[model samples]
Structure formats: C-alpha cells, structure tokens
Target: MILCADIGGSFIDFAVVHPDGRTEHRRSVPTPLDNAPAFIGALVALCAPWPDMPLHIAIAGVECPDTGIIHAANIPCLQALPLAAHLHRETGRAVRIANDADCFALAEAHFGIAKGHRNVFGVILGTGIGGGFVLDGRIVPGLGGVTGEWGHAPVVIPPPVPLDQEAAETLVPLFRCGCGISGCLDTIAGARALERLHLWAGGTPQTSRAIFEAWQTGDRQAGRTLDIWLSYMGAGLAHVINVTGSTIVPVAGGLSNAHALVDALDEAVRARILTTTSGPLLRRAALGADAGLLGAACLGLDIRAQE
Candidate 1:
C-alpha cells in the first residue's frame, strides 16, 4: 500500500492506496504551520507508527514547485525550505512536492472530468482560486510556479458607454483580496465576494452562508452577485480559452457544490466565447476534495510506470 497525503491550510488528510487505486484507512489532522521543520516533525509524528510501511509523498506547498522549495502563502514558513530534499533525508523515501492546485488538476485529468482530454485546464474555486494546465498527460505547471494562480485575475467590468455615475456608484470599493489586490475576479466572485454583496444589500455578516442559500431562493443581490461572478469569470476564461485552447475546463473546488452556479458559469462562457469550432468542455470536478491524494497516487503510479 502507498501512503498518500493532501496537506491544506486547516488539515492534512491521508490514506493508503493499494497499487490498483483503492483507498484504505483515511485520516486527517490539523496543520501546525510554524515552519517546514516543525511541520515535518508533526508529520513524522503522524507517520511514526508506520515507519516500515511503504510511503511516497506528494506535497502541495507554497514553494517553488519545480525546485520543491516551500514558499506557499498559507505555509509562509515553508518558504526557501528544501521540502523534497528534507523528506528524502528524514524519511529515506522518495517524495514529490507540487502546488496543491496542480495536484488537483492532475487528479481531474487522470481520473475525473478532464480525463481523455489532451489539453486541460483545471480551475479551482475554493478559499482561493487556482488553475493548472496539463498537456500530453503530464502536468505543465508554468513559470513562477503559479500556473494555477488564475484566482488573482483582475476584473474590469467597465461602465456602460454613457458612463453613468449612478451605475459606477453601484461598483464601489471592491473586496480586498488575499493577493492584496482590489477587485480581483476571485475577490469579487468567490465566497467572500458573495458575502460582500450580501452585506452591501443590508444583509448581516451572519447571513453569509444564507447568501448562497438565498441564491437557491433567487434573492436579488445573491443572483446579481452570482451573475456578475459568472460574467467576470467568463471574461477571464475567454483569455485562457484563446491562449491555451484547452479542451477541458474542469471546475474543481468548494463552489462546485453549487450545481446552479456551475450551470450559470457554463452558460455564461458559452455566450462569451469567440470561437465557433467548439465550446470548451466545462465540467464540475467529479473528484471533489480527495484530488490531492488521488493525484499524488497518480504521480506515484506514473513514476512507477517509468521505472
């Protein structure tokens, strides 16, 4: 059995995957993000009982994915840490470190929505947005190790031709995003974006979850926020579709739980695209949250195949 793990800001989840791809004995624990060594110590404690067990690590960290330097935003202490190298020394086993989003994309392409597509872009809409592209069955994470950083794309929804001041007033101080930017597409369209609009409409912050709930009930502000998100997302995706010409665009993240949102997103993209040859096949990621470990398993399987 191969021990597979997916580390997130809040939790680190793991399971054993037999050679044929069956999962066994899954578990999760809160992450202590003091630094790479401390985090590694925690992981070591977690794995102490299983020392003799065969383990191959696939990591998603805030580091240079190619160099295995952990420079992730969530795990800022991992910056400049030789994560892969340390894993090899401490565990005496092979380990792989990649951006979490890229791992998710790898999972989608290998066993989920992006399967069979030569060129695919995996879009993740979660606490933050991330995108990753794959070609010829391999993860092609671009330079800056941020191929999946599509969440930070700027949203420029210009005023109508006459530039009405009232309409411009409707677009007041946008959300301050994690990327420290104002009016980011993710900031405007993600869960936080929904909350901002709902609050602006005189809804309480406690009513945040109710915002999505209200979307189901067709609340005006919720619907408008959803619609605006889809519009901005489509505008951003148009650039991706034009540039990469990817065959698949799989929506994989927390937002995927909302079927109506996905439907609206697909419809908006179809309406916005400039191409006639074909619409980019947009799919909700079927792999859900297990993608990190599954894709890590996929990585192990790929390496074994090469050997």
Candidate 2:
C-alpha cells in the first residue's frame, strides 16, 4: 500500500492505495495553511499508522525539480520549502511529490479514459484553467516543473471577422490575467471568466450554470457570450493539441459537468485543429474526485518501480 495525500488549500485528503488503484483507510483533515510545522505534522500523523509505506503527495502547487522548492500560492506555508525532502527527514519514509494536475494526468493515463493512449493531456476547466501532459504514461517534467501551463501565455487572437456583416458585433478585450499577462485564454475561458464574459457581452451577471442554461434555452445574449467563449477556448486548445500532438484529452472540473457545453467545446476544437481524427479527442475525466489520490498512488508506484 502507498500512503497518498492530495493536499489542496482547503483540505488534505489522505488514503492508503493499493497497486491496482483501490483506496482504503481514507480520511481528510483541514489543511494547516499558515503554519509550516502544523502542515508537516498533519501529514506526519496521517502516515504514522503505516510506517513502512512510502508517502506520495499531489499538491496544488509546483515543486521546482532543480531546487525542490514548492510554490503554492494558496498554501503559504509550503512556499519556498523543500517539502518532500523535509518530510522525508522528519518521517523517515520515502516521499514523492508532484503537481496535482500532473498527478491527474498520470492517473488518467494509467487507469482512466486515456488508459490506452500513450500521449495524454489532462485539462482542468474549473475556476481557473490548468493542465498536465503525460507522455508514455509518465508525467513529462519541464523546466521549473511547470509543464502544461497552457493557460498563462498570451494566446487569444483578434476576433475573426464576421462573414456577412460590415463589422464585427462583438469585441473581446484583452483582459489582464492573474498571471500578469494580457490576452491569456485564462481571462475568458474559466468558469468565473465565463461569467465575466457574459456580463461583458451585454448580459446581466449570472452564474456559469445559469448562463449555460440560458444559452440552452436560446437566449440570444447568453448565446453570444458562449460563442465568444467557444471561439477563444477552442483556439487555445487547438494550439495546445497541435504543439503537444496528444492523442487524447481528459477534461475535469466544474464545467465538465455540463455535458452539452463540453460537447460544444469539443466540436469547436475539432473544427480548429490541423489534423483530422475519426472521433472526438476531448472526453470527460472518468475518476472524478478520486483522481488526486489515485494519481498520488501512481507517483508512489513509480518510485517502487524504480527500486
């Protein structure tokens, strides 16, 4: 069994995972975000019961492969700390850590919808956009341990000229992203960003769900917002697909719940991609919430394989 923890800003989800992806002794605790020692202690106590097993963590942050420094914006205590190394010293157990999104991709490649695919790109379309790339069933490490961060770059293109109109009816502004970049896909593609886009497109402020629902009911204003969304989002994903050559994309997050929206986005992406495929490339992730823990297990399993 591997002691696996999915550490997010809100909670630390702990589980003992079998080699085949089954989890036991599952539990969760509120994460100690402000205090470093408390954060370390929480994990230590969780793993104490299984002293012989190694600990694998999937964190909501990036760990620098070169310096072992973890950069988690939400969990302030872990910033700049060599988390895995510190935990190994304190607990006397082998420790492995990876970005949560990377873990998600690894898990999906190993056991979920992308199981048979050698190249998988897992995307999270939640409050913010994030992604991870897995090649040949292993997480592809990058410089600064920041692989698959497709959302941060300036990729939004000028709105396409309308075919039958004298001028374009909608114009998408290059809103500044939290990453400090203008024209990033993240500014208009995430769930919250979708709401912002709805308002910017002359609709009253509404939740992403409400907007999608309104669009489904043929509300013209809502439809306009979603059209803009699909255009930029599809273009961004197509650029990613072209660059990565990923055979499949497993999508997870709040937006993935809307089957119709995912279908629409999938169709839009297919239309934009350079290469043709017999079927859709994007599929809703299969593992749901268990992806993080299961992914952490994959990390531990990799260590054992190396041994």
Instruction: Highest lDDT: give the candidate number.
Output: 2
Model 1 residue 297 distance off true place after TM-score fit, in angstroms: 1.2
- Give stretches of model 2 more than 4 Å off: 157-170
Tens digits of per-residue lDDT for model 1, 64-143: 65666776567665767777688668977666666677777788888888888888888877655678777766678667
Q: What's the true lDDT of residue 186 in model 2?
A: 95
List runs of model 1 lying over 4 Å from the truth: 45-60, 65-67, 157-167, 170-174, 200-209, 276-280
Candidate RMSDs in Å, in order, are 3.4, 2.9
lDDT (10s digit) by residue, model 2, range 42-103 = 99999999887789999999999998999999999987899989999998888999999999
Provide the clash count, candidate 2: 0
- Each candidate: what lDDT? 0.71, 0.91
**Candidate number achieving the greatest TM-score relative to the actual structure:** 2
Angstrom error of the Cα, residue 174, model 1: value is: 4.4
